[model samples]
Target: MNIWNLNLRHLRALTSIARLGSISAAAEAINLTQPAITQALAKLEIQLGQLLFERHANGMTATPAALLLAPRIERALAHIASQRVTMAQLRALIMLADHGSYATASTATALAQPSLHRAIGDLSVALKRELVDRRGKGIMLTDQGRRIVRTFRLARAELEAGLTELASLQGVETGRITVGAMPLARARLLPSAVSAFYRAYPDVRINIVEGSFQELIEPLRDGELDLMIGALRDPSPGADVLQQPLFADRPVVLGRVGHPLSLTSVTISDLALYPWTVPAPGAPLRVQWEKMFTDADVQLPNVPIECGSVITIRQILLESDFLTLLSPDQVAVELEAGWLTKIADTPEGLRRTIGITTRHGWRPTGMQNAFIQLLGEVAL
Candidate 1:
């Protein structure tokens, strides 16, 4: 169901009624007449196609639907933090924030430019804050505007999650899970888990967005992604994200199949006597690579290329005598095809923790939880 179709005020009334246990009390709390609150509940029930309350002489008791929806409504409202903002205004501002221009936002939403302008203007007045500022031919959100946009995105997620849960209770499997995947996870971990999950929940959609951690972290924080899978960072990425270690991946020194290092017992000095292609500085693999040279008291090798793409690195390794540090899983196909071979183990058995990262307090829908379980099973 499109959450935009439901009235925010009615949703508030539902939560209020559930909390207060009576229509008159809820009406008094929200400063509405009892009849108005009753009508709001009635409308909500009809829209949801579920009975929300059981009437009694003493008070109204919440039904299963209300019990399921009320907490989500409460949490969503808390994220919104204002009863004065309307859904139209929220939609307008979010579009403006995303698209960055009145004309562009109108084109994207099919909303009239004047309507979009009015909605944002009215919203700013209601919130007592200037949300957007004119800058040359374009516009930009003020800091306050950006904060509100993030909160609104989170609020929408909560409502959508509630709807997904409701659908599950009715034996309908639906909803989408957006995953942010870094290099190593994409190679094998993510694909294996996704294959198993798809077999069990064929109706659910999964979107895997591939990028480095730097490229994907903000989107994950903004509620655009359900989770990220990759090597964990030392000193956790931030207080807002939680990492779960699935397995320890010890990287190996890799080169072309007939490289000199592959034919003999390799030492750190022997490994350092060649040009290397490694991840950009500050990457987990790069840090480990640096530490290997540091421990050996050998000068770092001449790195002609700073790269993160395994496919490109593989091509470079196959065509030239270059070495790189990588998880064996990342190049499993090439290893099996004789296109690449392990030159040596990373010195001293240095290993990186491969894991899943998610919002610190995220509550996954049942389908999302099931997928996470599958990831753990595959890792084992």
Candidate 2:
């Protein structure tokens, strides 16, 4: 079905008819004639390739398709509305959301109360939903209105990014890249690439978000992250994102500079006697740490901390005798600074592919592509 034919008027007709249960009521709600509302519903059904409602003697009964499509239609309408909406209206909405009152929103936006009200009303009309409601002394966003606000924020970010890229094409190079950094990238890889990219394009803004796999994937899929850097997941990471291998890194046991394990030739069993700081259970590094003990017929060590932060883990290693298995790339700077040392060799065949994760079909802008190329240079 060609979605372009299904306009806001058609969507409004569908939602109103489903909610009010009659064409006449739907017409009155949207300020359209009964026949116009009826025609809109017919056109919507044709474009969607499904029946939305069944007509009865008394009124229209919503079909399963109608129920399924209502919320989606609302979201789609909101997204479309966000594009057509003016900056003043969006600014008014944001201020209204923050202040929770039309008077305060007007104060913040430096617009008159009626102007602020009109802006919000225009946006509400575009989205076909009431955005805010008055309570005792404050205003609140409706559930659908919250969704619109969230989507509009994302839209604003994308628009800003696009404008930044447009400026970059003229050789100005002022832009922002939001990177989702997994444990490995936070250590050395991202820092090195960021430094190099900054040297070349100092005007570019780089924001790194640190997270575990579970925490970062959704943001990557939602266009919130330009790309994710860290270990590649086996099998495909669903069909929404593409994983590109940049390098392979093996786990290395690390400790304080003069720790007991660093002085002696150590076996996995010999190292298992001490307290350890390992990755959280089910992490790629944690899985490899367990397998190391299994191969050597050793019991797992007492894990005082199952940490995911390389920064925190490095601090722990610096302050204590606890040992941990991690990718060497995660501690290159600390190792170079002589604060930590590699205590034991990783088990043979214990290696993970570190790579980049980006949404499928995502196209990088000029500066984004340049930063990605810089990552390739810094990666092993």
Candidate 3:
């Protein structure tokens, strides 16, 4: 009666019943008898301690619990479809996805053509969808099949991570950490922290994903990223994400080493004299940049380029006299390398909180927690 002992057949039965809205229809979909479908539903309800459907004269109506549980069931199925799907099957699908042909997949996996097709057939059943379709001599994944493949890959990664965690607990050398890096952190804090982390855990793999706030936040919420390091947004970015402040960061004017403005003490008016590169509209940095100008009673200078790319900005600054406003940490390396020079700190003392943003209710694994501790040490 344990829910954990629930089998794929029972879950599929429930899914079919909920979708088709009848025990008879569900039975036909899975090729089981109506009475068998009813028995499966009854057993599932007992184990779940809730009614999944209300039996009616015409058909079965899904209960609220069934409605709520459907998506979770789909996600769970996507993660670990069934014991029926072996590694060989996943390997076949992966090869087929890449080569776009069963014959090619057979050659790559060293599996026979029939064996590969059979494995895919079993996988399609476990996923309750047609995964492959033949167009002349070629084969391709259905839309649902493609989605299943993506979700399955993520699930496989999670499973691998679990195994790696166990190995680490047993004193084995292995682990991986995925980090989402935003502009401010990428330039200094992240690199320093990563360097320190590597010295301690060289066996652990590190992946740094760089993107703007909007690009990274969704993935963090979806559990694709362990944590994000960057300029913390004001007003608490979202209720689902929690931000921790490590230090205060303020905007500084930066220009190439020999730019005219870098040679002299500059005021707000002097800044207005040059064309500039600034963050795109609606970005947090853009808001700060505009405020700095307005506070100085200086008309905003002409911006020939609006950008968020650190690489592009650095390149443009190196080649031209166009100035830019950026967090000091963001351009720390360039300044130290003598490729860029700071004009001055924002006179109004504008500041942004620099820190980590993680999904709410997320608990970091041991090594991940250790890495976060290292980030805190470096931040201080």
lDDT scores for all predictions? 0.91, 0.78, 0.78
Alpha-carbon RMSD, candidate 2: 11.7
- CA RMSD, predictions in order: 1.5, 11.7, 10.1
Q: List the residue pairs that clash in candidate 1.
A: none
Where does candidate 3 have its weakest 10-residue lDDT segment?
A: 154-163
Tens digit of per-residue lDDT, candidate 2, span 1-380:
22323455777678788889999898898799998988888877776566789999999998876765665455544554643566556667766776778887777767899988898899888767888887777778998776666565544444455445435544578868999999888877899999999999898889999899889987776556889998888777799789999988888899999998888899877798888888788777787888888877888889978887888888998888889888776787889999999998887788888999997766676788999999999985
- How displaced is residue 278 in candidate 2, in Å? 2.0
Clashing pairs in 2: none
Best candidate (score: TM-score): 1
Lowest-sum lDDT 10-residue window in model 1: 344-353
Tally clashing residue pairs in candidate 3. Answer: 0
User: TM-scores of all models?
Assistant: 0.96, 0.64, 0.63
User: What TM-score quantifies how close candidate 3 is to the native fold?
Assistant: 0.63
Using lDDT as the measure, the top candidate is 1
Q: Across residues 5-69, which tens digit of lDDT does each residue of candidate 1 receive?
A: 78898998999999999999999999889999999988988887788899999999998878888
